[model samples]
Target: MAEHNTSEERADDMQTQQAIAVEGLTKIYGTGESRVAALAGVSFAIDAGEWVAIVGPSGSGKSTLLNLLGLLDRPTAGRYALAGRDVAGLRGAELARTRGELIGFVFQSFNLLPRETARTNVELPLVYAGVPGAERRRRALEALDRVGLADRAGHRPPQLSGGQQQRVAIARALVGRPTMLLADEPTGNLDSATGADILDLFAELNAGGVTLVVVTHDSTVAARAGRVIEIRDGRSYERDTVRATPAQVAAPRQLQGVLS
Candidate 1:
């Protein structure tokens, strides 16, 4: 496995070291008196298939960064390259098309249609991509099998438990086989055990070489990632990569006041 990874890294280096590259990225809202800077010269690179976690307190530029990376918002200044192609300037139909083809997103809220079954919900992305009905079912079923949800494919959101619903959302994200999976607080709505199960699924996907960038405030969630990055006040606190196992990063945050 180590040798295989080395070969893959060599191949990646032969092309480019970055899967997603951002340089001097900035985002500003409004103008003059009402203007606010969401991102100020933010820059980062995520290598192909790297599991990176973005952690920060509320109002911290976590969501802002995710939006830019996910192609949901355009940057005010600077450059962003996705898979070696310049995407910062893409607009209108071209931008939307590129995003649809290159990115998959998972959210804290399952975001599944409550009225639809899991299989149907998972098929929606392929449907938008214009895949034929037969092919869409094939891919969606494959994705559900990968996430261990094939047995529950017919269950509606209301009929399934929280964890099962999140798994369905993951199946939908995977059905597209996108270049990157961008998740925003994916386990925020679940109880601890269920959230851990979701994190375990992420770990499995990362092991299979899916590029993952997760934005989360939960320390336990952050611990599951291969690399953890902290953002504070719209700026990075520690840019250096630190090597730590899940056990290391999971140390309980020290409490300052009386216990409950």
Candidate 2:
């Protein structure tokens, strides 16, 4: 009985150490009758290395939830724990430091400097993290290589194709070696083929033990995750596990098909 009790306690401790923990997270805008509750009592857990897709309709609190999780916005009530640390109350430099070390961000706009080369753009995160110059270049080049953009390292954003530019953005995200990635509409600006390529890269990264939380309303994009999390009025709804049916399966293919 004592051994069994010890095992149970260990399991509970493991859960507490998850990559993310959201509890009763609430965010409100305005005051009085005009007050808009962006998030209600949203709560969920994301384990390290899990690829979780969050899908919801417009005004469904998707962006609001992401902002909270990313530490970019504050919660009016409740708590958030990232890597087991309570960050709900952190502000200013403390919050900025935590955001730098623990989280990576990717946006749909391919937020790269048009004037900077792919390699230079990928180095920006390291610069913020205060890594040494030589080490920064090494890591940036490694990241670019990982995303198959090494050949285009010297090319500016305008010179690279849209797909390549997105890849550069992804490399920038990874260059920080962050614990989890928060992508908001990562493929929103790309064509179908290009978007598919970006998804493939995400799969490859997730397979290699990078945690992913993607905010997308696109059904096809959401379907690629092992689990789908929907946020409505700031509450999380883990609707169902998503998988490709036998009819939907294709021949063994590249990174894009791995999740499916």
Clashes (N, CA, C under 3 Å) per candidate: 0, 0
For all predicted structures, in order, the TM-scores are 0.78, 0.79
lDDT of 2 by residue, 1-260 (tens): 33666876756555543788766778998999999988887767778788899887788788788888888888898767787777856888888889889888886577799999999999998887789999999999999988778899999999988778878888898899887899888777677876787789889878887889999877778888877887765566777522321111221122112112
Q: How close is candidate 2 to the true structure, as a TM-score?
A: 0.79
Top TM-score prediction, candidate number:
2
lDDT of 2 at 230: 75
Against the true structure, candidate 1 reaches a TM-score of: 0.78
lDDT of 1 by residue, 180-260 (tens): 899988887778876887788788878877789998988888877878777666655333542332211211111101001
Model 2, position 56, has a per-residue lDDT of: 77
Q: In model 2, what are the clashing residue pairs, if there are any?
A: none
Q: Which stretches of candidate 2 lie over 4 Å from their true place?
A: 1-5, 31-35, 158-162, 241-260
